[model samples]
Target chain A: MKGLIVKDLLLIKENWKQLLIFVLIFIVIGLEGNQILTFVPVFLSLMVLLSTFSYDDYNKWNSYAVTLPNGRKNIVRAKYIASICLSAFAILFTYLLITISGMMNHHLNLEETAVTLLGCWSAVVLLQSFMYPLIFKVGLEKGRIFLFVFFIGVSALLGLVFQNIKISLPVEVISFLNHYLVIILPFVMIILLYISYKISEKIVQKKEF
Target chain B: MNAIEIKGLVKKYDDKFQLGKLDLTIPKGVIVGLIGENGAGKTTLLKAILNIIHIDSGTIKINGEDNKKEEKKENIGVVLDNMFFPEILTAKDIELAMRGMFKKWDTQVYYNYLKEFELPLDKPIKALSKGMRKKLEIITALSHHPDILILDEATSGLDPVVRNEILDIFLNFIQDENHTIILSTHITSDLEHVADKIVFIDQGKIVLDQDRDELIDHYGILKCDPSQMEQVKKEDYLCYKKNKYDVEFLVADRDKTRKKYPNSVVDKVTLEELMLLMIKGVK
Candidate 1:
């Protein structure tokens, strides 16, 4: 496990600059720029993760991992642990930057800042819990293609509906979302994460190379 | 106890290939060449032995323990055509990785192999040429001083000069009379001089497995006039080939036949000739 973590840390060391850029971009999103693009950094982090995954795929390193002294379970666990750690890092980085910016602007409050950061991390985890399992099942390339097309199609359809009609979200619905997101989103995402582990084990077992 | 043993090891990939119930015993202290045609389960057998490929049904033992046991890997070192290292890592990084990964890793020996192989220790693995990358892998695998080594097509891409140099290292390792190697290669001569035993696998079954000297002495290549081919005992030859003008058959023993047919052109057989004759069959 320590060896696996060292490997991951070396990878992170190679990409520290990019990770810093992600934090900078998100701080900009939270502080001064359009709030809409705050999702971009977390989303962009996936590209870094995807590129790493691509490196592994192209090199056929996954097969080698199993051949090592490490067990297949550790190989899979290392990947998930790497992903989870990165997710937490992004959450911490984004939260700290936002809080610092707020203090500089003299509008800093602890509760609201914590809430926003929690929201960002939760949303990213929820999306990852869905997307990563798909990636594991189908592979990084095909899964990314399917997910990209589906995300775009859904976004466009939502845009079209919004443009064609004006149905303002009710106050009750907004309050329900705010109150329920913390309780509902994580529970669902955790279950999905567990399912992904099971699916990943099955995929690793059956993979030929 | 055998260093390695396999019983009823069956692996099938649809109609492409099948390794059916392979029974093998590799005792300690000898190099074994696994010779086979392309897609003949040379790599598949290595993979199955390493548990890199899923097996249908069978048992594999290493040092009298199940090969599947995590602790068993401590005694096994493997080199394949595939790159096992991450692209971004340098040889120095690998030294660190291996130190943590393998309890027996010897840094001095690792660098010695790098110096011997002329592979740069500071260059990123991806930046190195194919041969250099392979050298790094060889260094890493050997650093742990595994009792048994398994190499799959490990020497194919290397130039003859480099291959010869590496073969010298293999010979040195076997001098201990306790280390073993299962080398898989199409270049029959690569393992020809070094391998103690040769196992010819064709379409996933053991076509031939015998001690090198014994097989060489027993297996004689007899070239004769085409018309004289029918006179040779059919059962005595493992297989034979015929051209319009000449005939060549690999007989199991030269001395036995020499006593019977002094005039027959009986010559020593090579692993390359044997492999080709076996694969091409009588044509």
Candidate 2:
């Protein structure tokens, strides 16, 4: 596992500048997203985590890595752990900055802030769990295109129906942490991601090259 | 002790190629040449030995352990054409990455190869020439000091001078008797020079497996008239090729063929001529 982390760390260091800028754009766009950017860090971190698979896919490095001592299970776990850690880091960074700003404006609450961060964290985990397997099974270029078309088309059509239903401020998604499935969902995702790794390994093993 | 034991190996692709039930054994101290034309399952066989691909039904054992066992990798050093290291990485970066990965890694030996190969340690691998990239892979593969080295067309693209230097290094490596190498290539001349055993594969099956010197001695190229080809019995020879001007035959027994055709011309068979006659099926 340490070996796997070092491998990725080396790669991350080599490409950190480009990667930092890529994630910065996501955080900026998420800040301007429909929800006033309270959960922008969550999306930024999720995108970073999700895109790691694409980075591996850029060459046949995934297969080459599989040929090493660590094997594929560790490879999958490292990616999951890396993403989770990055996401947590992003949320912490966002919380720290927002707290400093809020303190300056004299409007800070500790309990509410933690709860909201956890809610957004759960959503990002859910999105990644559902999305990464597809990206792994297919690839990033096609998978991201499919993601954009499906969700954007659905939301565009729903915009008409949702306008009639009404809201105070774009359906406060952070309040949805009440469900028990949110807790079950992340574990289920981690498990599914693991299984996907094995499946992908098996598929890759059968490949000639 | 056999370095690698492959028995009843069968790998079939859907409507494409088939690796027959291959039975092969490479003893602990010899360099074996896996000679075949393109798409002859050389890479497939190498991949199967590494357990990078599952065989349909067969068993492969390496260094007394099942090839399927994950721990078997500790003893094997494999360099295939497609084992692409990230082009952006330098040899120093690879060194850092592989430090703890291989238990037997010799950093000094790795550095020695870099010096011997004259590779720029800090240059991005993408910036290195193709031969230099190959030297990089070769250096890394050898750094681990694996018991068995499986090379698949690994030296095909390099110039003869570099290839000869690397081959000399391999020859020195196999002098230990604890080291064994299986080199797969269509370039049979190199095999003729150094390979102890020549395993000729075609389409997917091991068609001819023989000791290199024994193979050279066993067969002779017979050049005769077309009429003389008709006179030679098919059962007396393994394969024969005929053109409008003359006839060529790959005789299993040079002495017998020489005796039978006293006026017939007999020429020594090189690995290249032997492969061409066999694959082209003697017209």
Candidate 3:
């Protein structure tokens, strides 16, 4: 597993300049808007994870990986580990940016910021959980198409919710769901991520080189 | 103990192609050359042994244990026709990755091979030529000190000089009495130079499995007319092909056949002739 991780890290390192440019662009966009800063890291981390797959696919590395001592199961696990690490880095970057911006702009609200950060983390986890199984099943190219369609569908649903649903939830109900979500979402996402990992393992195990 | 054992191994690609009930045993301390034409299940058999592709129904044992075990994989090294390293990674990066992967990885030996092969440590794999990439693959495969080395067309695209250099490395690899190699190739001449045993496959069936010298020494092609062909016993010949003028018989026992047919012209069989006769001749 360590070997597989080293390989992935080296692959990512090759594109460091491209990633740095992405970070710089996001940082600039982030200064103008706090939401962009909060969400871009999650997006960037996912892109980084996807780029590793692209490299793997290009050289058919997965076929070679099966011949290695770690085998296919560990290969799948290594991708998940890489994704988790990248997501963690993105979250840390988001936190630092938000903290710095908060210090510079007194108008930022701490309570609202905490809720938004939690939401960002949940989104990243959910995206990974959704994308991983698809990638394992159909591979990165087809999985990317599915992920794109899913994102578009989600955005459309959100647009509908904001545009058509004028009725507001009761304050008691809103507070109840929000309080429970803060506690429950992370646990649920973790469980879902575990299940996703297992599914990916099964998919990869059945795959022919 | 044999380095590899397969019992009733069957893999089906589709209706037209299938490896049916194949059984083979490759003993330790020798190079077993797997000779076959394109689509003859050479790669399929290699992949099945490595567990790269799932077998439909079969048992594969490596070094007396089930080949599927992770521990068994540690003793095996593989090089496929297509190099699998990430193009963006340098040879040094591969060393780092392999050090973590193989428990028996020898860093010093790896560097030595890199120097010997003249592979640049800093160049990305994509930047290297085809022959250079193959050399890198061979270096990694050898550095781990595996008990069994499985190569599928590892020398196909290499020039004669490079191929000879690689073959010399293979010869050196087998100097240890415990090390074994299963090299799959259509290049019969390469096998003739170093292989101890030869296993020929055609359309997923084992056509011939014999010692290298046994085949080279005893196997013969008897060229005779149709009337002379009739005089040769059917059981004595492995297979025979008839041209317009003469019949070519592939006999397993050359001296016996020569004694049996004193007037017939008997010629020594090369590995290429053996493979071609098995593939093209009727059973």
Model 2 lDDT, residue A34, Cα: 26
Model 2 C-alpha lDDT per residue in residues B167-245, reported as the tens digit of each score:
8878988999889999998888888888999999999999898889888887898888887678888777778777779
Q: What are the lDDT scores of the predictions, listed in order?
A: 0.78, 0.76, 0.88
How much is B228 displaced in model 1, in angstroms? 0.8
For model 1, how does the per-residue alpha-carbon lDDT over A1-209 read when each residue is reduced to its tens digit? 54665676676567789778866766666776233544555556555666666767777776776677854666667667777777776666656665666677776676765666566766766567657666766778998888889889999999999999999999999899889876777677777777877777777766667
The top-ranked prediction according to DockQ is: 3
Worst 10 residues of 3 chain B by lDDT: B67-76
Descending-lDDT candidate ranking? 3, 1, 2
* Candidate achieving the largest TM-score: 3
Candidate 1 chain B: worst-modelled 10 consecutive residues by lDDT? B130-139
How close to the true structure is residue B247 of candidate 2, measured as C-alpha lDDT? 81
DockQ of each: 0.53, 0.37, 0.74
Model 1 chain A: weakest 10-residue lDDT segment is A33-42
After TM-score superposition, the amount by which residue A27's alpha carbon in candidate 3 deviates from its true location, in angstroms, is 3.4
Clashing pairs in 2: none
| Predictions: Cα RMSD each | 3.5, 4.5, 2.6
